[model samples]
Target chain A: MTDIIVGILAFLGTIFVFLAAVGMVRMPDTYLRISVTTKAATLGIGLLLIAGAIYSNELAITAKILAIILFLLLTAPVSAHLIGRTSYFSGVKLWKNSVMDDMEGKYDTSSEELRSGFETDPEKSKPTKSSG
Target chain B: MVDRIIALDLIITTGIGFISAYSILYDQPALLDVAMILALIAFLGTVAFTYYIQQKNKQ
Candidate 1:
């Protein structure tokens, strides 16, 4: 019974990991690719680790598996975020059909700064300032 | 740019995990140790890459 469960989990994990790789290849832009790969890979690896722990049934092995899973969970998203931010800053263009770019006018590529909406329009703030 | 690198890292880590699990299934204890070391290497590689990206972006 335990063997059957472990095999099933491992199989599913491999499938998910494969899907993530396919997504990475098919995605149009770096941002979309990162988003797809990160989510799928994290879940796949988590499942795989769980399977390992279940199959081993040994305290030390299970503990190590849990530690790896915890490390992966905590770091995966953060690394993805950092990579995405760096890519955006580095001017990796978005997909052509991408409809809404929240960072469209807010981010300055040259300076690597993100400006508030109010800061982008001088006219909006002119009225509030009094000439001395 | 860095997104691709990170994605590649993730794929490699997943492969390592699979290999580790395969070792356990085969009753090869030494291979399990290798898997643990690989996992640690992967984690450290990610951290280093993140730091490199930050440094590159700042300049």
Candidate 2:
């Protein structure tokens, strides 16, 4: 019974990990790619870990697994958000097919205050203004 | 979209953890050792990567 269960888990974990790799490499945008790779990979290794924990029944190992799970749960989304937001501000264009930037239009362009203040520093603008 | 996927991953990981604990309590010492290592590695990867992800965001 135990062997059967372990075999099944190992098989599933391998498959999921494979998909994660494929998705990471093949996805169109960095944001989408990271999202897929992280979530899928997280699940795959998590299963593998659980398999190990069950086989050993060590309390320390179980505790470690719990910690990992907690950390992943807390952080993956924030990472993806930061990366996506940074990439956007850095001028990596979103996919043309992207329909809605929910964060969009909320940025009222007419407001100079919307600009990151450091970007328009007197010294830097002086050069561009002088050139013009 | 990613939120749903992450939620799903959390569920599966938790379930797998329970299953692993069950296996450990049983007689599969080999499986138990493997599970423990896998658990450690997974936790470490998530924690490390979470930091990596967060740092990437900060930059």
| Candidate 1 wrongly placed segments (more than 4 Å) | A120-132, B29-33, B50-59
TM-score of each: 0.83, 0.55
Q: Pick the candidate with the highest DockQ.
A: 1
DockQ of each: 0.51, 0.12
Can you write out model 1's per-residue Cα lDDT over A2-104, one digit (the tens) per residue? 9999889988888888888888888888889888888888888788878877888889888877777777788778777777776776667888888876766
Error of 1 at A52 (Å): 1.1
* Tens-digit lDDT track of model 1 for B1-59: 47658676766767766676676578654455565666667667766776787687678
The digit string of per-residue lDDT tens for model 2 on A66-97 reads: 66556555655655565455444333455667
Per-residue lDDT value at A5 in model 2: 76
Q: Give the per-residue Cα lDDT of candidate 2 at A55.
A: 52
